[model samples]
Target: MDEEILVKKLKARDQKVFQDFVNEYKDKLFRLAMGFVHDSFLAEDIVQDVFVKLWQNIDSWELGNAKLSTWLYKVTVNHALNVVRSKKKTSNVVDISQFVRESDDGGIEIQIPDNEKNPHNKLENKELAGILRKAINTLPKKQRIAFVLRQYQNMSSKEIAEVMDLSVSNVDVIIHRAKKNLQKQILKLMK
Candidate 1:
């Protein structure tokens, strides 16, 4: 369905249209949340909450102000960040095993040839992925969000700027710095 039509139906409280919208974007929103929180359950919760908020505010959404997808991304990111903050406040112990498990399923895995079945190669690839995930998590909040939106979400700088409410140049700079920081952290981890 066209976005305008979808929005119109949503604004009219069409349950079927809202269900379709949720089905279409739920996975994308979940992955975006996972990129921040690194916990599947938490990410799922965040996505659900975002959708609920979206439904509640659908009537107020200004159609031409921003794309619906952009608005969704912005809300997901903000909600995920808040969850992360609250989690930090409630728990000081970092869960190493959770990070290791997340490295495999958080959509940040390094691609390896399926033809290469060597156990050693697989283990090394997993280690590299864990290192990369850790490095990404260490970045400043803005940089990490910008990098995830650009890299994992495949969003352009302009799109990221719209979602983040930043200048396009500023989004570019954040992604650039994020790459540099990730490289440095990965090298340090490999050593």
Candidate 2:
């Protein structure tokens, strides 16, 4: 079924369709939540809470001129920012690009450390991922979202703009600044 039809069915209060919607998006939503919250347990809870909120507000929903996924992404990002902001200190950091697709099952999987590898190389790889994640975490909200959607989620600038409710030019600027900031941070780390 096409997404539009599925969404329409959901809007019409078809309970089965809602279940299908959940099945279709649960993994993607969980990944997105985990990307932002950087905690597996908390991210799972966040995804579930967001879905419950979506169901409760379904009756009031008016699917204006946006894709369902984009709307969902927007809601997810907002929820994540709220969660992070509520923290008094110690923001969460995540290495989103680590979740790469594997050929065996099409599952999102990061590279696992080889048991036979020397400790030093393993430690170095761990340090690199950490440094990269730190640089990404320090990005401003808009830039971070734009960069993550673009780089990690493989979303086009147009899709990111819709998800973020930003102009295409603004998205371009965010990407530019995000790359610049990441470069500067990487250089700082290397020094």
* Model 1 alpha-carbon drift over 4 Å, by segment: 89-134, 189-191
Checking candidate 2 for backbone clashes, the offending pairs are none
Model 1 clash pairs?
A: none
Count of clashing residue pairs in every prediction = 0, 0
Poorly placed runs, candidate 2 (over 4 Å): 2-8, 88-112, 115-133, 186-191
RMSD in angstroms between candidate 2 and the native structure over all alpha carbons: 8.6
lDDT of each: 0.79, 0.72
Residue 9 displacement in candidate 2 (angstroms): 3.2
lDDT for model 2? 0.72
Worst 10 residues of 1 by lDDT: 89-98
TM-score of each: 0.73, 0.70
- In candidate 1 the C-alpha lDDT for residue 107 amounts to 58
**TM match of model 1 to true structure:** 0.73
Q: Using lDDT, give the best candidate's number.
A: 1
